[model samples]
Target: MSLAAETREAVRARPFLRDALRAGLVNHSAAATWLAERAGLDGDSDAIAAALRRFREDLPAYETDPRAASVTMRSGVGVVDDASDGDGNRAGESLLLRVGDAAVVDGGDRTAILATGDVDVAALANALGRLAAADVDIAAAGVAGDALVCVVSRRDGANAVRVVEAALDAVPVDEN
Candidate 1:
């Protein structure tokens, strides 16, 4: 049978295997072994082995598209100050800045362009500019702390990957 067909059959034979696969606990072979061990069955290794091979073959279909991946950064600083309360009690004040997810989408896909991280506004703008220069469509953008979040999209798959890569590269590396 074809790999897809074999995978479907394997899933049908053992529904719990789906959870195991999704959880990343084991591949098809280990899942089959687990099932066999639980059922106290022996000499069924061949069947399980075949099913695992088919599942492995079909894994590429479920893999994330590299072109769709994005990069993001989150960085920030904090400050504390001493203060006096109305009751004459000592108190402290705190301030913080956090950068959320920055991403690139095709038009308005909403998928992040990069993993989230803290980045500076200048670096973020430079990245955005680079993406725009490459003709990557930007849906939205925001800046938090030293980080910038940008959404970029492109009609071509290759272009999307290029844009995301360029934007990520524009982020400045910390020397300290």
Candidate 2:
């Protein structure tokens, strides 16, 4: 079986990584190399990358009912959707600017911070650093269009929102 057919368990175990991969934040080649060394999986980087790309593309379609979903493959080729051609090309993609104020949501065991409006990557980085400094355990982080979404320990959620706000406010506005 190809890596795509055999690697579902391994990929599903690292939910955060899967999210990052889908978001185009993780490099596919590097991930393939890691899989080879760590999981004893051997395959061409391009092939593995293609598989990962497919995995990412089909992921959202099954988000609500992932267990009931099945991977549809034929002749070792996966189906492609119109929104994503599965060509493994992201050359022309652009980041969306976040808008509005950050919101903190409590999810019992965890807290989530949803930030929007002019979201600066650097500011988000700084906010993450601040969270790290405070020893807050971040469960996950992702960029969804104009939103910078982050999940931290429930106790740290409100503080995390403030940290993001402070960092975003500190960015120097362009006069031009």
Candidate 2 Cα RMSD (Å):
19.9
lDDT on C-alpha atoms for all candidate structures: 0.46, 0.54
Prediction RMSDs, each to the true structure: 16.5, 19.9
Per-candidate TM-score against the hidden true structure: 0.30, 0.37
Flag clash pairs in model 2: 98-117, 98-118, 98-119, 99-116, 99-117, 100-117
Model 2: residues with Cα > 4 Å off, grouped in runs? 61-134, 137-176
How do the residues 95-126 of candidate 2 rate in per-residue lDDT, one tens digit apiece? 12122322222213555566766554554565
What is the lDDT for 33 in model 1? 70
Best by lDDT: 2
Lowest lDDT block of 10, candidate 1: 74-83
Local accuracy of candidate 1 as per-residue lDDT tens digits, 1-176: 55445545656576345434433456656666765676444436667657665564453322221222245422221111222345433234222222232222222323334434544554556566676787766555566644345544323334544565665554433221
